[model samples]
Target: MSEQYEYVPHRLLRHRVRDIASGVEGELMAVVNENVSESGVEHWKELAYIRNASGREFTTAVANVVPT
Candidate 1:
């Protein structure tokens, strides 16, 4: 008998910064929001509220499985 594996959707926060002087852009930060179990079940809720240096508030919600 063959075993089947299930795929679950994961979510993450990807942030990037842009340099106006050099015209360069790259990823600045990445945060994992959720983690899925071996059975492809999400065990936690992904919710984060962040504030930037510019006083900008950003909220993100993701439901995914990630390694801790």
Candidate 2:
């Protein structure tokens, strides 16, 4: 007999700041949601809002798996 496995979902948001002169990047924030998972195995999805020094904001989303 085959054992059934449960799937879990997770959400995380990460931020980074870039230094133009030094060409270095630094992490600003990391947001995690514990209630996003149904089981121990975590599946992650990310959404990012990036602001540039010129005051321009860019948004992006990343997913672990694509659903059809």
TM-score of each: 0.23, 0.26
lDDT of 2: 0.36
The local lDDT score (0 to 100) that residue 62 gets in candidate 2 is 27
Q: In candidate 1, what residue range of length 10 has the lowest lDDT sum?
A: 1-10
- Which model scores highest in TM-score? 2
Per-residue alpha-carbon lDDT of model 2 for 1-68, expressed as tens digits?
A: 12233223323223455434334344323322222334666554443333445656543332321111
Cα TM-score of candidate 1? 0.23
Backbone clash count for every predicted candidate, in the order shown: 3, 0
The digit string of per-residue lDDT tens for model 1 on 1-68 reads 12232223324234554333333344323333444345665465343433345656443442221222
Full-model lDDT for every candidate: 0.38, 0.36
Worst lDDT run of 10 residues, candidate 2, spans 59-68
